[model samples]
Target: MESYDFIVVGGGSAGCVVASRLTEDPDVSVCLLEAGGTDSSPLIHTPVGAVAMMPTKINNWGFETVPQPGLNGRNGYQPRGKTLGGSSSINAMMYARGHRYDYDLWESLGNKGWSYNECLPYFKKAENNEVHHNQFHGQGGPLNVADLRSPSDLLERYLQACESIGVPRNHDVNGAEQVGAMPTQVTQLNGERCSAAKAYLTPSLTRPNLTVITRATTHKVLFEDKKAVGVEYGLKGQRFQIKCTKEVILSAGAFGSPQLLMLSGIGAKENLDVHGIPQIHDLPGVGENLQDHIDLVHSYRSSSKRDTFGVSMQMVVEMSKAVPQWITRRSGKMSSNFAEGIGFLCSESDVQVPDLEFVFVVAVVDDHARKIHASHGFSSHVTLLRPKSIGTVKLNSADPYDAPRIDPAFFSHPEDMEIMIKGWKKQRQMLESNAFDDVRGETFYPVDETDDKAIEQDIRNRADTQYHPVGTCKMGTPDDKFAVVDSDLKVYGMSGLRVVDASIMPTLVGGNTNAPTIMIAEKVVDSIKQQYALLKQTKTASCEPS
Candidate 1:
């Protein structure tokens, strides 16, 4: 029967930060519980090792979407992190803050204090930009953000092609503008991945006020009347309960958090009744409004002999020689974030914001692994951003171990498919451009682009998720029935309970989500501190003069 000032569940991206920040005060005690184990794998630390962890359950939740009619009823694989750092530990490491308009939309929807200008400081506070120290970037923060250590020649040509196509080169996408070709900044520190667990939890583990317990699966939130007082969880086949004197924060990510909420009788009433659980709060938005990015890869067999695929032996020798150089000097191919080059563009000229994101990889990625062909190979992955389609996440049964029902309904909007088709055409034209004339070879996908309908069908058949799932429990004003949390991230109708993960996003950000999730955590920490301080002052005033 242990009790604490605060109990944070799911020690992933947001939970780690909440627990660490809450424990900063000497009088407050905090406990963080995580179902996953430590983030100690070599694959998690190495920048290039993400390729190996994609299809495996080693550090992933390996869930799949229900049959998506837009993709001809084919199920799509959805991978999430199941380790200490969560998905941030196993992601591509791109550091994108999304467009300013994204946050303005939240404020427009009655969520105050969420404008781009207000949220920008949180993004800066969570990052330790290695390159510059300006109003937009912090110098000595915990999370490391830096330029690509290894720049490939093919990527340089790709950037040139973008320039030739009227798109300007942006030195920093996270700066004033985000509508150009640029080398993506990554969350890495001296070539190692800098996950949230690494940045926040690792250093705070030794704090006397903080206690971190891994391998603890939270079953449900304990409520008396309507107030969340504690949690019920299990560890090593033993069930346990812990009371919370202050609050219970859920950071189990987009899927897990919603699933837990539903199991605790806090979701749609119909869903709860069907699952034989008593309805405590009928919040229908707990698992609705799911959104994600769908990507299509166009591979090309290279004509040049200098591609990374053909330089395997040379690469090994280079790595062997560069190891010591890195040990002493810290530079070279070993420091690269694999996704060397990227471009942002709109599908139509009339569109104001960029709708498509292109990632250039030096090696070929067949299924999920980075498979090197006998000849040199390169790939261009076109991702549709800001999709109009939405989906849901539901529990299969009431089992916590069972994977939830994830239906992204990708390409549900006809316009979304049209955009991908246009992206495919744009990719072909870029390949045929003079910038790649010396290195171009045969196209690997949609082998025949002459037929428009065939190209569209091919894209639908081969499309893959970029593994960015968000917006299940959105944040908005009380008028929106589906809105689970308010602008301050407090769960609607529930005291001492809050959500601080990607689940709080009203809409998916325009680009990578890892950095944005971290930014949300940073912002929510300040809100929590302000609220706690106000409570402390009120208590002191009440006791002083009566």
Candidate 2:
């Protein structure tokens, strides 16, 4: 069996950062296993490649949820990245840290050392923002964040529309306040996708102590009586085991991490008995409390093709010219991140934090863009930033390859549905503003916008996930029985194991998840490094000329 000081499973957003930073110590040996291959595809580097990746499995896991009764029995599309950078490489690349109160809420939930004041350093440590640099933003960091190169005129109009209405304009959402409209800052460098792999992993290749294994799927965590000592994985249908002398970290994302734990018999005992698998540890919270940002999109058709990625003969010709423009100058329509404009707002003033987040796209995106439209158009994605509904990720079968049963339980809560309708009403308010007169053409989503009942019906028929799923293996204090991992991220009642990903979030944040997921890694690696140092110190003391 291959052995290392630390073994990190799932080379996604958090895994990449953990492996890279852990190996910074020349003495520590680290091994990173990625279920997918390298992040070297042209589609991965190009900013506009998300359009194709949203539908194809070239770099995506392409998991589909069970039929959601809330969305009129619709099975939502869940496309997670299956490559070196993980979803960070496949996501919209928005660099948001949620609101300051979001982290404070973590502290309030019995998770110590996770407040906004404590987490700000880690956020700063992981970022290298090109435009903003202050007490909030950072420079000379591993993650590269910048503004979009060529935002569509329609995106600008959307922001103008936000201001034209009562909504305020925020230049930086990741700063002091996160309650207004602004152009999104993306995780990009030189107009290319700066995924976690690009910012943290690629540059770490020169370190001889670090090893990254690609296309390796983890089957289970090998246990010694109770403590995890190694991982059993497979590649090309062959099984292999690797020992970690110190720790085995599950950074396989929200879905992948919980699924692996349940497969290894560390989840609910009742569920394990159903599959006839022996229980290693009975943690009922292994796959419970699943939360996601449920979204409702509104679209409008426009006449100009050059302004959007919508279907048109002029768009085809313009795209032909865009190819060379990107190949040479790295600037043009190809440089757009598609979701260029963002807004965060409150449904009710009594609510302290904003519950609604709007993402303005340059093209018509519906049903994960599966059903293509004929006309040029733009879409406004109004997502319930924090849904109260709960869900689960249960095992389909004992087989490791089988996908888990994902039930996000979207709109199961009556309040969530009401909030969903309110979010769409806000989207309508922006669309109806005069800012869209020169650009906006025809409203196509609600059909009838004024009726509240019609809007609620529309939500039930069309609402789905915004691709941000979290809290399966939640982080909380031990008093919370269903908490999977503690404030330190160690799995409850287990040693030598930890979960570092979106799954560890006790509650979903208010904005995009990619940036917060990376920050989780930066914070947890310090914990890992300290443990490694103690292990080294104990060994040195024992050998001191005794």
The per-prediction tally of clashing pairs is 0, 0
Highest TM-score against the true fold, candidate? 2
lDDT of every model, 2 decimals: 0.84, 0.90
Off by over 4 Å in 2: none
On the 0 to 100 scale, the lDDT of residue 362 in model 1 is 74
Compute each candidate's TM-score over C-alphas.
0.96, 0.98
Across 1-546, the per-residue lDDT of candidate 1 in tens digits comes to 899988988888788888888888978999899988898888888776686777788788888889988887889888898888899888888888788888898899898999999999888888899986777887777889988776677887888888877667988777888888888788888877888999988999899999888889999999998899999998999999999898989999999989999988999988788888888998999999999998988877776544444446665676787677656755665555667777778888998988888887776766555344665677778889888889899888887778888988898888888888888888777767799887877766645777779888888788878778899989989999999999989999999999999999999888888888888988998998888999999999999976
lDDT of 2 by residue, 441-484 (tens): 87776457678888888988887889899999999888888999
- Summing lDDT over every window of 10 consecutive residues in candidate 2, give the lowest-scoring window: 440-449
Error of 1 at 368 (Å): 2.8
Off by over 4 Å in 1: 303-330, 370-375
Q: Tell me which residue pairs clash in candidate 1.
A: none
Which has the greatest lDDT?
A: 2
